[model samples]
Structures are given as C-alpha cells and as structure tokens.
Target: MIIVSASDDNFVPGLLNLLYSTLFHNKDAEFYIIDAGLSNANIDLIVNFSNRNKIQSHILLADKSQLDRLPENPYWTSAMYARLLIPQLLPQHSRAIYIDADATVVSDLSELWTMPLDGNLLAGVLDGSVHQEELDHVGMGNDEYINSGVLVFDLALWREEKTAEQVVQYLLRNRELIFPDQSAINATVKGRVKFLDRRWNFFSWKYPEIPAITPTIIHYTGDNKPWKKRRAPLAAIYEAYRKLSGSDFPRPRDLPEFTKARRTVVGLFSLRPKYWKIVYYTARCRSKFTTPHIRQVMARASQLDQAHPRKP
Candidate 1:
C-alpha cells in the first residue's frame, strides 16, 4: 500500500502521529509525504525517523507556482489542494491512498488498498457534515458528495481521464465554493465515485457511537482539532498515537478556561438548523439503547482486533 499525506510545519505533530498510527497497524506499506513548506529541520526529522526505522518513505516538494492558483482560506492552507496532483507527482504508482494529515488510522489498510474500484476513479466515504444547500450549489445530488479526506485513488485512471487537470480547472472556475477541493472533485467525477462505508472515514463529531462497524480512520474535522483542544472529542486516541510516534515536539497549550467557555457559548448560538440532525445522531449514539445487532457487530470487530493485535 502506498499512503500519501500532505502537511506544512504547523501540522507536523499531526503528521507524525498519523505516520506512527498507520505504521503500527500495517506491515506492508510505504509513505509519500508532500512537503508544503515544512522547515528544513522538520524535514530532516521525518527523513531521519524513516531511515532509522528502515521504512520506505519519500518527501515530495509541491510546486508553489501551480498551487498558488487555488483559492486559500484562513481555516486551511493551499496544501489541501496538493491531493489533486497525486497522479502527476507519482507517475510510477497505479494506485494510492490519500489520507489527510489530521486523521489517524486504527486498522490495517490492506483491505482499503486492495478493494476493487469497480471501474470508478475514486472511492471515499460520504461526507456526513455536508448540507443539502451545499450539495445543490455544487450541482450534485444528496448521495453524490464524498468526503475528500480518505480516498482510494486509481492513479492510472486519473491520468487516462485527465482527472487532475479537469479538477484543477473546475476549482479555478468555482473559487467561491464552500469546500473548494472537495466540491470540485465531486462535481468533476460525480458518477465515477464509489462511496465507501462511513467507518472508513469517521468524523470526530460522531464520537462514542455504537456504529455497526468500528471506525478504521478517525478524521479530526472542524476547528476543534485534537492537538489544539484538550477537550476535543476522541482526543485521547490521538494522544496515544502521539506518544507512540516518539515525537519530542512540545504539546500545545490548552485553550484558556475563559476562552473555552466563551467558545462554547458562541458555538451554541451559531448552530444552524441543518446541524440539528447531527446533534440528534450524537445524542442517540450516547443514549443507553444499544441494540442487540449493534452489540453483535461490536463483538465481531473486537474479535478481529484481538486476532490481529497492533504492532508494539
């Protein structure tokens, strides 16, 4: 499996945690880290770590001249657009798994790597946080939108179809999109995407759930990132990986008590009606009403984990 992720200096901790978690779970995988303005010291750290561990790794520097064409936001850097260049970056590989730096893998990715694409150019989970209005704006149906966080890409197909070029053109034309790259990819390859089970790319808001299947990849979506917020949902899992990664980076200071309280109040009032469904789902998951079927599913997943314990 070839795992690709992009990050700048600001996200180095998250990137290291992602690398460690993925390596801990998978035995046969290589990594390609896209350099989007990482400092020279940090780049050496990653290269030295990979060399010390005898891991196959490559650091590809992105072309700033091309990436500058994509619109940027305060919330995300232009590095987010680097995934569109995967086919062009690695011409030797026929397929690759693109995961966001903010996510951590908890299960073996071999299944995801080898899953038949069924002639689709990309495979990813449906975005749970998207609204109907956003879908309409992107000219996609309710079910057509897929999260760009965790994607299984058919690189050869992308090259043949000129998908990267088309996606870049779409994004340049639609700069006002709420989610630039995600909406562009969905719009460009509407019928050509295969939706995977949600467990493949679970969002942080859906934490502590009794889902039919356990989440293999936990995505830290939204602003309350695990590295930045001590109270962020599923943060402990991320911390475990941080320690496992053997990173000596200083931990970020938690938000001040007053600031945290203020943000909570502000967040409450900012919630729109479209978010009520997520609130209800979260409430239901935490409720003491786990069905027998859900229990069985959890048991089976637990058994599988025990059978294939994570590497120390």
Candidate 2:
C-alpha cells in the first residue's frame, strides 16, 4: 500500500487532489491516509471528497498523542514517523511506502512498492547536495544521511529495529538540536539503508543536473516551489497538482535582476569557454538576491511573494 501520513496543519487539500490523480492514472494501487491531529470535521472533508470522487482507499485518523509516544519537535512529528512503525500500528501489513505531503506521483508506484528491501532497515535516496555538510555537522560516516521526504520502508523490520524509539532516544540524548529528522534516521539506521535512484526523491535544485525521468514520485523539497512563478526547475509536478486541484494558485513573477542576470549568464556560458567562470559568477550573484530586497526596491513587484509565509 502507498501511504501518506500527515497532520491537518501540514496537510493541503491539493495533496488529496494529487492522490486522486494518481488513483485515476493507476488503478492497481491502494492509498492509505493516516490523518494525525485532524478534527473529525476535517476528516469528513477528506472522506467526503474521496467518496464524491468514487476513490477507494483507507482513511484512518488518530490524535497526535495516540500516534507517537514521544514529544513533538520541528524536526520530527507523529505523522512523519508513524509509517516507520507501521507493523506495530497495523501489524497485518508487512510493507509500505511513505510519501511526504509536498509530493506527487507521475508514474505507477508499484515498482517502487516492490523494491527489494534486501534486509536493510530502509531504502531511500541520500540527499547528495546536503551529504557533506550533514556528515561534518553530525559526525556521521560519508553519505550516511537519507532524505525522509520519500521512504520505502520494510515495516516488519523497522518495527523489529524499534527505529522510532531509537530516533527519539537519539533526540533525548543529543539535548534537542536535531533540525532535520533525517539526522536521527541516519544515526539509527547507520550503514543499513539501500540507496535508491535519485529519481525517487528528486529535489528542485538538482533538476538541472539530471535528464528528466518520468519519476514514480516527484518531491518539491526546497524553498523554490511550483506554487511560485520564479523558475522552479521541477515545476511540472506542481503544474500537475494545479491541474488536479483546479485552484488558481498562480505562479509568482520574476525579479528583474535575477531574470536579467540568468539570461545574460546562460547566453555568455553558451558562448566561448574562457569567459564561462565570469558569467557563472554573475549568474550566481543574481540567484542569491532575496525577494524581500527586490520588493523593498521595486514599486511594481507582484510575483515575488515569500515562498514560505512570513513569521508573525
């Protein structure tokens, strides 16, 4: 079964639309919605939407305290890790695939679901971009971290391993500085993860680096999301979500400096090699300019609203 474990707060209606799209395109799969910390009213909205659409999938709800025994933090939540202990929660199920709310399936997930666990605790892609910093910051061995954004877990073994307990213990022992849940996962699983292809947990920044594969799932794992108009390289996934949602989530406008600089650099880099570094540096500078800075200076700016809502 393919499962999406999420709370009402992090949950978006668009996510259900994405699930509907996947079910429409692929009929052989079952989706489980594990609703953590949602009111019965909100749960009914989800269930009614599924019923109206004639979508058949299990919809389960639990309070946060019921879902996890440990205290919550920004890095780890009951919804995110519940699937890891799926065997204990739903002991009949021997395996399951976990997806983040900020993702969509482009291809059939059956292949991903069927991936050989090979006695490993988990199977997922390492965030290649963050590998070095993670290793240094946490003192982990090279390439030890795996992005929790997409995980194909062996539920039985994960329960046998008591991974959630280990993760919570790590957090307790470390004095509460774990910023990303992946850090605790890396510490517990250590050398036991089966590295999957980059296509599974494909992030936005690396989209330019690899040729596009019709991925089983596409993850919007960075600040530049498809909800914005500024170039998010892997925006087709969001576009797909937008189509399913029928919501006018307009893409934001571009900053002139970044736009002008990106164009100038791409044009220059497309030319002779000797000037490549100069043009590259200029492009980098443009990319680094903040939207707030642009908004502060430009009177006519519209498209550059903060990707994340500003804190109160």
Candidate 3:
C-alpha cells in the first residue's frame, strides 16, 4: 500500500510523529510526504527517519506557487490542497491513502487500505459539521458529504474523471463561499464518494468519546493539539509517540504571535490561586503534574537519615 500526506514546515514534527505511529502498526508500504517548503534540516530528519526505520519513503516536491493563484481560504493553508495533486503525480500507483498530518494511526492501517472503493473515486468519513453546508454547496443530498481528512482515493477513477481539475474549477467558481479545500473536494466529488466508518477519521473534537477502541485514526481536528495545549484529552496518546519519535523542532503554541504573547503575559502575572503554580512547578521540576515528587521526597529522607543516625 502507498500512504500519502502533505505538510508545510510548520507541521513537520506532527507529520513525523504521525508517520512513526503509523509505521509502528503497519508494514510493507511506501510513504510519501508532499513537501510545502520544508526546511533542509526538517527534510533531513524525515529522510533519516525512513532510513533508520528501513521504510520506503519519498518526499514529493510540490509547487507551492500553484495554489497561490487560487483564491485564498483562511480556514486552511494551501498546503492542504497538495494532496489533490497526488493521483496525477504518482500515476503508477493505482490506489492511495491520504491522511492529515494532525492525525495518528493508533490501529493497523491495513484494514483501511484494503477497503474496496467499489468504483467510487474516493472513500472517506462523514463530516457532519459541514454536511448540510457541503450538500447545499454541491447541490447533493446530506448523505453524500464526506470529509477529506482521511481519504482512500481510487487513483484510476480520479484520473479518469479528472477529479482534481473538477475540484479546482469548482473552487474557482465558488471561491467566496468555500473556506477549505475539504469542502471544495466534497462539493466536486459529491455523488462519487463512499462514506466509511467514522473511526477511520475519528475527529477528537467532534466525538466526545475519543480514544474509542474502534478508532484506527485519531485526528486532532481542534486547536488543542497535543503538543501545544496543557490538558487536551488523548494528549498522552500523542505524547507517547512524540517521545518515541524525534522532537528537534517542536510546534509552537497554536496561537498568533500576539495572542501567544498575551497569554504568556497573563500567565506570568495572574493573581488567581494556583494560576501559575503548575507552570512554575513544572518548569522547576520538568515532570508531569501527575508524577510523584520523588526527588524532593528522597532528598528529605536522606537529610533525616543523616541527622538521626541509627546506632544499629
């Protein structure tokens, strides 16, 4: 199987961690990363990751300027649209899987890879948030809408139907209304998508019950990304793989520079009890809030032993 993903420099760490988790549970595949101005250092890390793990990985060079001509959509960066070029670029591959960088594969991906497209151009999980909007946008029924987060594309069908071209043209016509490439994809391929189990692209925010045993892919579809926020549920799961993988370049907090600075200001001066206690303690100790204060406890015990000299 061939797995495809796209990311810009900002998402390199998350993307690497995503792949590390995937490689942990699956086998015999070539991974493709669609590069959107990834720095040399980051690219080297990714390249070394595949080499170290002995996995076949390729970094497909994407022309970032291509999307610059398209109408800007604030909801998502143009990097997200890079996947649209995959089928055409890698024409040798008959089928492919495209997962967002914000997601981790907690279970074996083989099941999703084997899911038959059944002549459909693509297969994906439903996006209820944009269901009505997508349906209304594309003039399709509510049931026809699917999220592009975790997509299983039938390359042959896509190439034959010129799905990418159609999606781009649709985006141009509906430029004002569409704010995401995902909505555009669904609108263009409305009737041709087969909806899969939600677990395939189980969004962390949408479903309150996340880390559900059934979810093969856990998507961090909200602002509380595991790396940025303090207490996001399922953060431990992401941290597990994050620690297992490299972390040379960590993702900054998911805030604008001004917003992040403002939060830091408040955190530094807030008089609310326990407001900065956790931050200060964690900074001094460098351990999780749940961890025992072993170092301090052991030091106190040592002092007591020295002062009370047992004669025995």
Candidate 4:
C-alpha cells in the first residue's frame, strides 16, 4: 500500500516513531515522505533508517512557494497544508493513505487500505473537538467536519474532480478558518466525504465511558505533545514507539507541578466560551463519570509494549 505523511525537522522524531510503529504492523507498505523544510542531517537520518530496514521509501521535497501562500497559525505550520499536493505529487497512484506525524498505528493498516471508498473522495474519522462554530465558520454543518490527521484519499477521483485546486482556493479565500486545511477540505468536499469509525483516528484525550474496541491509531492532538510534556495523557504509548524506533531524542524533564486549585483555574480559563457548558456538566458528573477506561486502555498499551520488548 502507498502510505503518505509530511513533516519538517521539528517533527522528525515523531515521524520516525510513526514510521517504526507502522512498519511493525504493515511490513510491506511503501512510504512517501513529504519534505517540508527538513534539514540535510534529518534527511540523512531518515534515509539511513529506510536503507537499514530495506523498505521502499521516497522523500519528496515540498513546493516552498505553494506552502508559503497557505494560511498558518502558531499551532499549525505550513507543513499542514502540504497534504493538498498529494494527488499532484503522486499522479501514478490511484489511492493512498495519509496519516499525520503525531500519530502511531497500533494495528495492521491493511484493513483500512482495502476498504472500499464507495465513490467518496476521502474517508476519515470525525474530529472529537469539532465545534459548531468551526463548522459554521467554514460554511459546513457540524456532521460534515472530519479530522485531516488520518485520511484515505481516492487519488484518481481527487485528480478528476480537481479537489486539490478546490481546497487550495477555498483556503486562500477563507484565511480566518481555525483549521485551515481541515475546514477547507470539509467545505470543498461536502457530500463526497465518508465518515469512518472513531477508533480509526482516536484522539488520546478522549476517554469514553466504555470503549468497545482498542484504537487502531492513536493521535496526539492539541498542545500536550508527549515529547514536550512527560505527563501528557497516554504518553507512555508514544514513548514505547520512540524506544522501538531507536530514537535518541531527549526525554522531557521540565514537568511543571501545578497545584490542584491552580490547575482547575488554568483549565477553566483556557477553555473557550462554547466549551464552558461541557466543562460545567463534567464538573457536576465527575464522580459518576470517572475515566477508568482510559487506565484500562493504557494498561493494554503497556502490555503490548512489553511484548514487543525494544532493545536498548
């Protein structure tokens, strides 16, 4: 299968871990790494890893001029917009799977690869944090929004429909979108998107009352990155992949000690007005709505890590 992902030097470590975890499950998968301003040293490391593993890998340099034209925010870089060039970049491929660098595959991807698109241009999981305001901002309904982190692109259809051009134009016109690429794609594609099961692109922060199945892919969304904060939710799973990938990246050490009252205050202040209602509900139901399922999922991940036994 053709698997595509984009990254720059800052995210190379996460990219390495993602590659290692994916290869562990899908050994024969081909990789297309979009080089969004990766340094020579970082490129060498990726090339060396691919060579040592004897995997089919290609690193394509992103078009800097095109990337510069896209809107960017403090949280997301121009690299996020590079996925828009996928259909153009890989004209030879009929279909491809695009996964974000901030995610790890825990199950075999062949299931996802072989799934029929049923005429949809793209397939992805719904964004857990999607708000009505975000959808309205992009002129889309709440149900139409999907996370761009994990996607199944029908490249043939994308090329035929000029989806790349449409999305780019939408983004250029709607610079105020909170999620530039995601919102643009949602608005542009509209009815052509296929919603997948939540387990496909499960956010690490979401703790369901009763998880029916283990997540096939774990995505570290938002600001609590495992590399920058040691105590981030589900960080051990990410750490396992990092160790398995043989990455010597330094561990995060400066974990701040926040008092309970201070943490509560900070969390309340950090939330947007739209989310205050949910927080209020959560506060009232904390005793009845505890997240023991998260601990169970973490334990399962820990067991899997132990079974794989990474070499030091």
Candidate 5:
C-alpha cells in the first residue's frame, strides 16, 4: 500500500485538504497522519472532513500522549521522529512511501509504490546539491546521502536496522553532526539505499535550466519554495492544491509574524542604508549560488529579455 505522512499544527486543515485531494485522485492508497502538536478538536475536524468526503482510509493518530513520551534528540523534533511510526501502522507490509505534506501529487503514485527496494534499506533520490567531491570533502560516501523529502523504505529492514536507536545514539555521541532526523537516516542507511529516479521526487529548484518540465511528482525543496518569494515555474502545482482545497496550503504557521517584523526592519534599513543595493544584490547572489539552477534560468531569461526587451 502507498502511504503519505504529515505532522501538522496550525496548518492541519490545509494539509488534510491537500491529502484529501490526493486521495480523491488516487483511490487505492492509505494515508498515515501524525498531528504532532494539534489538539483533539483539530483532529476531529480532519476526521469529519475525510468522512464527509467519503475518502476511505485509516487515520493513525499520534496523540499528544504519544508525542510527550518520545525520546529526546538535540537535532530532531518530535514531528520528525513521528514518521518512524509508519512501520507499526502498516498492514503486514514491509514497504511504504513517505511524502511530505508540502508536496502535492500531480500524477498517480503507483510507480513510486512499486519501486524495488532490492534488499537495500531504503530508496530515495540523491540531493542535487552534493557532488562527489563535496561528499568526499564532508568525509561521507557518495551512496550515503539521499534527500529525505521522499523515501521508500523496507519497514522490516528499518525495524531490524534499529534506525531509531542508532539515530538517538548518534545525537548523543555526535550532536554537532546531526542536523535533524533526516541526517541520521541518511547516515544510517547510506550505501545500503537504492536510488530512485529524480522524477519521482523532483525538486523544483533542481531543473531550472530546462525550458519545460514534465514531472510526475514535484517537491518544494529548500528555503525558497513556491509558497515563498522565489520564482517557481511550478507555482501551478501550489495553485492546484490551493484551488482544490479552497485554501492556500502549506502556509507557514509561524511565518507571518516573523516576516512582518523582518519586513518592517528592512523598510527601516532601506531608509538609512547607503549599502542597500549591496544587500539586495548580495541576497540575490546568495540564492543563485546556493541553487545553481536558478542562476541558469536567470541567465537564459536575461538573454531573452535582451533579445526582446519589454515593450513599453
């Protein structure tokens, strides 16, 4: 069975709505939900909406009690570890696909579900950022890294692998190396993982140089998301979810206040700064540097702009 996981707080409604649309599109899948910190009231609302829509599926509620009992890790949040519960919730199956809530399915996901584990512990696409030299520089093997945004796991192997325990131990022993649960998973399952096609977990940031995109599944990876200020060719994907859900999805629960304050500070700085242009260009340059695909797209766009300058 195919499975998708999400941990929600204030954005529970939007996530559920997106998942609901996903389910409607593919009727033969089961959804596993973890309301990491939401109240019973929110859970009820989700349940009632699913039921009303006649979306047949099981809901594995990671209640507050369960959330409170998880072992602590300096780099991992309860929400991230809550994903490990999928094996226990699966129905006599040794494999399942994990999709983040920030994602929306554009096509049927049976292909992702049928991906061969090949005795490897897990299967996922490699992050576009980490080159072979970079991996060596970081003292890691090339096979040891995979983006955690999308994962297909052998549940039985995961359980036997003691991944949870290993992650906790790594946190205790090497806290500095641990960024989050994904880091631990990549480290533990490294070299033993099967690599899936980039198309399955296609990050919008990875292929900006391409003139067109035909993605089966699109991931909103990195800090610059379609939901945020950066240019996203796949903004239509986000719009699809918004239109289906009748609400803007994946809205950051904690972003508005922080953004307002940040904007206010920036506005004040804009009035006083002799180096404001430097700051603006620096920010743009940083984005282009971090996500090279954007730079490629910008260069192409610049050429196009010069060839056909904006008509008055």
Candidate 6:
C-alpha cells in the first residue's frame, strides 16, 4: 500500500493536490514524496496540509550529489531523476507505485496495489505523445514505449538489476536526450515492461470520451496545467481536491506573454543560462543518439531473472 511521487518547488502545489486526491480515495495507504530541493516553507506547508487532511506522508530528500550526474532540463529538474534512485533509496520497501505530481488518482489505489506485476521490472501506461518514430528511436515496439508518469515497480528486483546505476551510466554515455530517466528505463529494461491501462494514467486529450465514472488516475500532461485558469473539467477536478486538501497556498498569477518575457529577462540575471542550452540540445537532437548506449546498458543488465515478481 505504498504510493510514491517525486517533486520540487515548481510543482509543489500540484503535488499537494495529487496527495489530496489520492489520500481522499485511498485512506489506508502509505505515501512518500522525494524531496527534490523543496523549500522548508513548502515542506512545512506540505506537513500542515497533509496533517489537516489526515493523510500520513513521508518526505525523502534527494541525494543531489548522486542525481547530479544525470541530464536534466528546464522542463524537468534533477529531482525528476530521483525516481530512478528509489530501488536504492527505499530498499526496505518491496514495491511502490510512482505517480507524477501532475496526475490525480480518483479511484482507490488499494485495488491497484493488489494487481501483480507478473515478473516485470515495472508496469506503466503508454505515452499519448509517443509515435512510431519515437518508439523506433528508442529501439522499442510502438506499444512498449510507456509513459513514465504512473508506474508500478518491483523495487527489490530493480535493485538486483542495478537499474539506477545502469541508467546513470546510460545517460552519461548518451548525454543528450529528453526524458532522461524515462528513456534510460525503457532502454535498460527494453521489452520487459508490462502495459497498464491508459485509464490509470489518463490523458486530458481523452476527456471527451472518458466514461461517466471517474478514471483511476487523471494525468495533466502537456503544457496546459491545472494550477491556473483552464477551461476543462480537469481544472474543476483539480480545484475540488485542492480545496479538499485544505491548502491555503496562494493562487499563482498568470502572466501575459509580454510580462512573461520581461520576467524571463529579469530572471536571466540570477539564473544559469546553461540549462537552456542543454534543453535546446536535447530537443534538437531528440533520441537520434540513444542506440549505442542503450545497447551497452542492456548488455550490462543482470541476466538472473525473477520467477514470481510480486507486489507488496
């Protein structure tokens, strides 16, 4: 009954809403958050927020020195890499479900916790943004390229495979790609991942066709986040749980493009310009360079396999 998620300052509010929705539906679940450089004030807010909602939560700080070796982007910080370190960090936990902060759980996770992985390293939904080309680039079948947003993992098995270390090595060799940890997971494990239902990581683009009954998990994929003013029911859903969480955190301000540009200009003085370059390089190159390193990581993976890979 363990649910895990990784977050930093940028997505702190989204993490709060996620916790609210998840704990509201599954009262008897253990929750953990990878503390990826969240402020003490924000951590205090999370503590008070969870306490007010009666949801028990554990915050695990990121080992920045370990995570710093991986590639990152402005779209995602080094905290995103923390998910890869779970098997090593939480060795005591046999299994856990990893959900993105941008996603919401509308169904009881206890049922999900009961679903067996059946000897797979992880189980996740396929990505909405993925295409045949992207799948080919990663040397995976179109259906095998999963969305890393929501995953059920067998941590002990992951540890035996040394997945976190292998992924870091793969990233070091590849150095230039988006979805760093995600791509690493796919490349290292290759075709071994089991596919979970898309409803578990339901994308907003499918909002029109979603059944009247609530989805298991609603993913706020792409740029149109629910934090600010948005037109869809997703926004309403997010707002509801946000209120349910009893969070009095300030509503973020929306800025026009001109104002955003001005703020960006001011921010540049205090920011390191190198991250923009790194993000640009990845976007421009895409996954055109993952082949060789991926092959190497695959070769390096443990050949000893587990028979009955059960979840906790």
Per-structure clash totals for the candidates: 0, 3, 0, 0, 0, 0
- Sorting all predicted structures by TM-score, with the top scorer first, yields 4, 1, 6, 3, 2, 5
Model 6 over residues 92-120: C-alpha lDDT tens digits? 99899999988877667876787888888
Q: Which residue pairs collide, candidate 6?
A: none
Which segments of model 1 are wrong by more than 4 Å? 259-312
Over 144-188, each residue of candidate 1 has an lDDT whose tens digit, in order, gives 789999999999999999999999899888877888889889999
- Across residues 40-138, which tens digit of lDDT does each residue of candidate 3 receive? 988898888767655578999887777776778776778878988998778899999999888887767887899888888889987776645545767
**Least accurate 10 contiguous residues by lDDT in model 6:** 301-310
- Per residue, candidate 4 scores C-alpha lDDT tens digits across 1-312 of 899999998788778778877886787789999999899999999987776545578999899999998887777789999899899999999999999988877778998999999999999998857777887787666566899999999999999989999999998888888888888998888898889988889887763321444577888888767887776656666777676566757678964667854666666688855457546544433323224433444565578667865433
TM-score of candidate 1 against the unseen true structure: 0.82
Better model by lDDT: candidate 1 vs candidate 5: 1
Candidate 5, residue 288: lDDT = 43
lDDT per model vs. reference: 0.81, 0.61, 0.73, 0.80, 0.61, 0.73
Candidate 5: Cα lDDT at 70: 48
**TM-score, every prediction:** 0.82, 0.70, 0.76, 0.82, 0.67, 0.77
- Location of the lowest summed lDDT over 10 successive residues in candidate 4: 284-293
Query: Which regions of candidate 4 are displaced past 4 Å?
Result: 208-210, 260-312
After aligning candidate 6 to the native by TM-score, how far in Å is the CA of 149 from where it should be?
Answer: 0.5
lDDT of 2 by residue, 60-173 (tens): 655456446554666445666455444556667777777776676655677778879899988898776564555676677546677887887787787877777777677566
Candidate 6 stretches with Cα past 4 Å from truth are 131-133, 212-214, 250-312
